[model samples]
Target: MNGDIKEDIRSLSLTDLEKFFADQNEKTFRANQVYEWFWKKSCRSINDMTNLSKPVRKILEDHFSFPVLHIEKEYISRDRTVKSTFRLHDRLMIEGVLIPDGNRTTACISSQVGCQLGCTFCATGLFGFKRNLAFTEIFDQVVELTNQSLHHFNVPLSNIVLMGMGEPLLNYEEVKRAILMITSEDGLGMSPQRITLSTVGIPNMIRKLADDHLRIHLAISLHTADNVKRSIIVPLNKKYPLEELRDALKYYHEKTGKRFTLEYLMFANMNDSLSDAHNLAEFCKSFPVKINLIGYNQVPDLDFKRPESGKIIAFKEFLEKKNMIVNIRKSRGEDIEAACGQLALKDRNQREG
Candidate 1:
């Protein structure tokens, strides 16, 4: 943070705000009012706190800044999926998506500017790591997408998936804080159950998330069950292999007593074979889990192709035959590059220019 840059007011806790008001010889309740405007009301500017006196607003304006992530550009797919390029205060860019299904809409938000986990199938990995988004930045994505949902689909955002750019567990602290704010009564008031954090199975961090017991859904991006194949695609697998990941997931289940989701992005002729399906089934035996067989969105220069429709059905049937809960998740927003593994910042040079 530069000295010239005023601190983000949302970074202060309720207690910190209350203390600040008391120090200014103001009523402590003013902090509660400001806090409500910050989170519950989603106020973008201090002047939007209409309930506050002008003098109080002046005090806030003088001390702290209310910077917001503004949309630089947005694209709508044929299926009504909206992909937005959000410009951060520092001029860094990130992406978010709003997918409308019937009456329900899901907002997929990014946790980091770019991903360090170099998954070969994901475009975000190609851009390389930049920085973790502040908790406020993460929360702002949801607010903006919620507005988009109402504007486009005439429905409120029903769910949130941290399945956008970077791995959530890699940026644990800020991600956790953002989740807390999103689910808290003082904030958006969305249910914890409505949120899902997708990650590439960081072993120790998985254990940490399990112990913390955040109560949100966990979805692992386990494209393949075979370690050698997994390592080739998801380079992080070479460091924390499938065995360790399995143990960590087992611990998560034992600790939380929750069934997590395994997201399998089916690649044609690679991990879509019957043997690979058998390996995936065997891997699921240790813990209670549901499987989401996702259709891979074709990224430019990425050789990984979507499996044939028949192969995808066969894979889903194989799991169903073994009494597993399975769903073939339809890839949305491929045209706008908002589907899974496709959220690399395409407007970087444009924003920089």
Candidate 2:
């Protein structure tokens, strides 16, 4: 009999769980207890499941492992931005960051190892694509961050952004499932509104995401408004240019009636001119778009530099004058490569050398 076969704690759904216990000649209620241990109790080890009989606990110990990321290295910036490298089971390195403002706590989790979106200005693009993170792996990030922070601060994490190291839409199924699981009442019990998914403008995934009509915030990495310029900075723009992206945004706004946030990383003397801001405002007229003006966080591998504060203010003012909603995003964690794409633990040049 296959009654003694073990199951991966992270991979099994509630249905597979029932079959697992059934194979063991145990009642279906046994599976629910196991599932709750993962989602509710968040036990450190299988032995911590005291509700389960000793034999069942032994069975679980022989079979399952707590999907976890081992913290290999950590860096904290003077500006209070904290970034850590988590080594997965297969030696894949991913980064998680905690950015704390007075009232807001944002934890950035990586969806994939290296990104396929070779944006010219991104540091991760320099590192070739590796693999996607499983749903449980992503869940592990939230749990670990929560556990770490609970010891330091009183409040739980207030924000979760899929913006650490990879393009989330490329791994849509796992990403979607992870989000659903994270926001599930039985799971993390986090409200959907507290999560945000950032994408590099994959139209197919964008359309599907809109169809899902998830109430969570969707932020688009829109660095440039001109198709030609955008195509150079963001290669995906070739497939979904300004026109197509506008159409997608319009559809998303229409379908969900949810306002989307446009993220613009301003590079000094590159794409932060007065004309760039004007073009940006003109492009976003089709739907309600909130503009977030980000100062390009500098990385040694990338040539792009953050625009001057005066220029950024001028750009924001121009958008406001045109009756567009815009705000300047203050740069955090610049001290220790705290910029979005700068947290690359592995040296790409050294690998190639």
Candidate 3:
């Protein structure tokens, strides 16, 4: 790369692209057309912009680079979930999962190369923080996964979840931009209601998201309601405790009038007691929230074990008795390491080691 080379054209917004085209003495409408190709069509090369003149395409190729993620490895589970390990331009790896359930398919995409929040129960945390993915990188996961869903299941992706690899709120700006591109009429034209952003409960950032007034759903990874127990598992909870998170969720619910989901992973002999269920039930009373009881997916080197069926049933019954909405989210693709909390690039980690 040369100092004189232009930046990634995909990084430019429509307004920036318009200015660039204007400076090039080209019609401003060309910018909109090119922007459509970059985002809407997810074109990987300047040559893919067939609507543009050869001279214009040549100019783009000479000035800008379209560094797209290449699928280095793909694993499919018996349950038909697909986990893909993508190699970025610098060869850093990130993972994304395509989860299928009947007619609906969900794309679980990553926002960063690795995770900054070191939740003890998570595999991504084992890698430490690598880098925040570019907005293009985030959007590319959705595009690629959507294609996979259509190809494998003969159905388009019905939902998108920012629940893979990294804490989405940490890469707020890029995630925000990616969401805008994803839901824009000229881009994917997907409904924001179909997207969910999951976080390990970053309080101030959660409040900020409320202020932004986005229509997407939010899911808080609140494995335990007790602050002491929570902090031991999700280390970020020490910074943003349950009280702060409660206030943030209150604000978010009041502002958007949208019900959010609280994700609780049931671990055997760990936060699966009757008292723990009571604490979680009380926590949900603060805001309009649905409880998603998820079974722990075994990760290498982690001592946490999935709770028995009887314990999960007892916990769900307890929440239901409290007049709270609860759904048990079945773990998908665990055999292929594509289940909930299992999106870490384990093969890459082994290779790096």
TM-score of 3: 0.97
**Per-residue C-alpha lDDT of model 2 across residues 1-353, encoded as one tens digit per residue:** 23765455768888987997888788889888888888776666677788999999887677665556677766788877777778887777888888887756788888988788889888778776888998877888888777656644556788899888889989989888888888888888888899999998887778899898667899999988999999999998898888988888888888899998999999898788899988998898889989998988877757788887999999999899989889888777778776676756654432232
> Could you give the C-alpha RMSD of every candidate to the true structure, in order shown?
1.4, 2.7, 1.5
Deviation of model 3 at 209, angstroms: 0.9
**What ranges in model 1 sit over 4 Å off?**
1-3, 348-353
What does candidate 3's lDDT look like per residue over 31-137, in tens digits? 99999998788898899999999999998888788888887888999999999988888778898999999899999999988898889999888878889999999
Model 3 bad stretches (over 4 Å): 1-5, 349-353
TM-scores for every predicted model: 0.97, 0.94, 0.97
**Superposed Cα deviation of residue 49, candidate 1 (Å):** 1.3
The TM-score ranking, best first, is 1, 3, 2
Ten contiguous residues with the weakest lDDT in model 3: 344-353
lDDT of each: 0.92, 0.82, 0.90
lDDT of 3: 0.90
